[model samples]
Target: MCACKAASVTIVDGLKAAETKEKCPLCREARVYEGALHMEELNILLSRRCPEYWGERLQHERIERIRQAKEHWDSVCRAFMGV
Candidate 1:
């Protein structure tokens, strides 16, 4: 499960404690405000790695875009030259 889900669980537990007028163990354990769970989720997402091919795929796309743009410009130049 993702960290956001885990943080949501912590928030839910904290809400339950609030409803019962009891101390929230999760908050005590993490030593953070309930709202800080969202920050924890953000941190977890930032620390996560993308798929192995993600960078390669992005590079390939960049190269393809450049190639296509060059091809289009070449065609435009040829048209202007009446070729």
Candidate 2:
């Protein structure tokens, strides 16, 4: 499976060509047939469905969780020092 974030387009003989591209047909159809709001929603949904997007989101969440834990620990240590 290709792990590209966006559809890879290439110029060949003055024409655009997609290279190793995969997308949800429903999403593409929605973007073409639906309004701006619907297109935006479909785009968000598609991005979330992508593995790279999910991986990045999970990594960010993990980093945030670690940061929050460290903050909580520091606060606890400060409280203990004052006691």
lDDT (Cα atoms) of all candidates against the true structure: 0.48, 0.46
Error of 1 at 60 (Å): 0.4
Per-prediction TM-score to the true structure, in the order listed:
0.39, 0.41
lDDT (Cα, tens digit) per residue for candidate 1, span 1-83: 12223334332233222222333345534533345436556535644665545566556656755766687789999999999
Leading candidate by lDDT: 1
User: Native-vs-model 2 lDDT?
Assistant: 0.46
Worst 10 residues of 1 by lDDT: 11-20
Clashing residue pairs, candidate 1?
none
lDDT of 2 by residue, 8-78 (tens): 32211111233323443446432222222353465478676897976786576567557666877898999
